[model samples]
Target: MMEDFSGLALPPLFGGHILETELDAAGVELTAGTTEILESGGTPQDIQKDTRELDKRKYQALSKRVKELEQVNERMLARLHRVQRLTRRLKKERRFLMKTLDTYGDDYRNAEITIPLEDEGGANLDGIPGGDDGGSSPSTTNQPACGPKKKRHRVPKEKERDAQ
Candidate 1:
């Protein structure tokens, strides 16, 4: 009858045994049985293949993520460039405005403007009071520039109203 060797500890090469002396003492009989089971199961080779496949999938996913990040970086760089260009343009415009103000600001503020009068039926200032034609002063005029003042009617106090 064949003994059940399934529960027996495996050798160090198969990731089971802890001691080298135990592995060496296990001898050819146990090694042969273990080899037979390993060959039939194809476990080690399958595990290596599966690990390689998983590594390939992980590498592909990482590569895809890298590409996405690179695209985002490129877009951010483009937006940054646009902002920088606008900033440069605004700075240039500000400089130009400052230069213009430095050159002509005082002149514009202190310049006096005179309008020549046309003689074509415009209002005659000669007949008006306080005119340059040497008319009477504004105070000597009978009527004031504003209308005459009106007299105010005062309201009675509370005690005066009760007495009335």
Candidate 2:
């Protein structure tokens, strides 16, 4: 792994690179994590023979750590986006529920369809099925719309048993 002392183009390990921070010990805050190809001509094997094993282990550990951090950060970013969307959905649902309560008052009971055609207060909070323009008051209505009872079709016992 060597040529006769011709410098800058040959090294113990061909195409050797050193971490930038290792090259410049001072003012390395800006150049950390960058690599610089070796240019020094001395036999790097002879100069730093003893530390190669240690450096190899450190490189493997650092590479694994970088991959691990990248995966965890990616998952966290995905979860953050999901949480943001959920927060927006919840806010919109809350606005809808609040508007429903304000327009109709606390008139609902166990999901009943008995919407009041008139209330004592002036606000016409009738949730009229098709005629609701969302701007009508109680005085605008000529007749009260009584919610019709839901018609239930009873399936025959023989059909129910067959479905089961």
Candidate 3:
């Protein structure tokens, strides 16, 4: 009976070969040849495993970077909030200072230095020589001696008086 090799997917039966399985040097040579083929086939699988390992490393690095960016974003948000609060406080202080300057009009100087607004008697000075205690200063020499004027409200005349 002729054996159908095409239908048999298995390797040739090792027992059917009359050749010696172990012929010293010849056996070693055949085994070495088979091992070389198997080693070549293993290369593609190794390359695939290496590619997967590289991809996993890249993903871990990107994840670590994202976490660092999130931490930076959180710190920036906190700083922005603190700056907003400080800005609000500075604005309130500026308004209060402006109101104070308006109340002390005429006695306020445009200089960038802080000068006392009151004397020993707690009276506002008008920067004039002989104006308060008769002491003369350079700022008082060219300016007139004028105290801050009290704001006044004029009441409307009565309707009967206007008619008359």
Candidate 4:
């Protein structure tokens, strides 16, 4: 039996040798590829550099956006203050007008006297002592109504004669 097995080339045992050679070849290819990457300043360092650059750009963009938002916030606050001031002024004016209306309401109502439009003879003036007829009565006394009476200036007889 042993002599027969030695003469017969037993088919490759489960193809193990072929699989080992393939694995070795794959490992060599992987090593060469890694070496090439290492010669070009290594993958990790390149990735770190790229990450740093991206972070810098993002920070700049975010800072710029923050500045813009702050400016907008300031403008909005200014507008809000202006609106509040206007509202306060309007409220003060409204209160002042309301007080004025209250103060004058009674006087306005009392002073209003309506007369009939159909009175062609004009309003009756009998209640007042003075008549509607346009004339003034001569004063009974010599004293002025408003102030002290004025004295007449009399020229001397000699000056009057000389002037004549």
Candidate 5:
């Protein structure tokens, strides 16, 4: 019976010739020294209470990590949604522009960036400005304005409104 340890699948019931239930501590996370256990009276309940406390601490740390990852995931999802919306809008705009170019390709290719020179006396095609009311800025002498011909007001996006 003493030489039959291979059948039990352990490296023999090793002990100091007195204790046979002692296990090797190869895979143990912590090994409380013999004197340390004796100082705590070696009570099983105390050992169990310590193990529970350790597990609770590990659980709390893992829970906090999971919450942080969840917040990051939410931010990533919102950014992804915003990117998808912008991509869709860009694709639609590109397709519309391509269609418009196909219809008026030659016109765009040949057209120069020149605003119809305001009437010499500042009288527009509408026959409306004789002199004082209709005035073109000296800064806008020749080159076309970068923006719209009229003072167009734009409705701001929600984010831009908040920023403002």
Candidate 6:
């Protein structure tokens, strides 16, 4: 395009512009020159530039990873809830077993059942079997019918020494 450089006014800051032109493949000539006065809308090419490439595999992998992580989190939560339930069940079973043992002790104390064995003096000890031997008395394993209040043993009484 042949630009008429005669009518163009150069701003005072840039002094003046020297016009130059070149022809394109379509025989349409293009002008090249630096102008001091700035225009409202400059070149259309200056608006934007594209540098994008498509990659579907990268997006698919990211989505798959997110889904897998979510599934793992769900499984962990379920396992934690199951563990809590099992722990509660175990504690309940333990308490029930202790209560059963206490009931057994009560039944024995009331003489609901009898076991046969001789005492230290060849006497038959009541309730449970396997009492102390005649020569050396065995340690007592019988729980008191009334049971202990504080559940602790006091120190044994000291034996007195005989003076000559």
Model 5 residue 84 CA deviation (Å) reads 0.9
* Superposition error at 87 for model 5 (Å): 0.5
Candidates 3 and 5 compared by TM-score, better number: 5
Model 3's lDDT to the true fold?
0.59
lDDT of 2 at 141: 55
Please, what is the whole-model Cα lDDT of each candidate in the order they appear? 0.59, 0.55, 0.59, 0.56, 0.59, 0.47
Per-residue lDDT of model 3, residues 1-164, tens digit only: 55655643233334434222322223323344445555666677775765565446545554654576578678889989999999999999988888898887835456677767544553536654444664447786666558656799877689957888
lDDT of 2: 0.55
Model 1: lDDT to the true structure: 0.59
TM-score of each: 0.39, 0.36, 0.39, 0.39, 0.43, 0.31
Q: What would the per-residue lDDT of candidate 2 be over residues 37-83, giving only the tens digit for each residue? A: 13344466743643454456556654754576578678889989999
Residue 138: error of model 1 in Å?
A: 60
Q: Name the candidate, 2 or 4, with the larger TM-score value.
A: 4
Specify the poorest-scoring 10-residue window by lDDT in model 1.
Answer: 11-20
RMSD per prediction, one decimal? 35.3, 22.4, 32.6, 40.1, 24.8, 34.5
- Residue clash pairs of candidate 5: none
Off by over 4 Å in 1: 1-41, 106-164
Report backbone clashes per prediction: 0, 0, 1, 0, 0, 1
Give the Å shift of residue 31 in candidate 6. Answer: 40
Give the 10-residue window scoring lowest on summed lDDT in candidate 4: 8-17
Candidate 1 lDDT over 33-131, as tens digits, reads 444655676678775665565446545554654576578678889989999999999999988887897786555546698765534344454555443
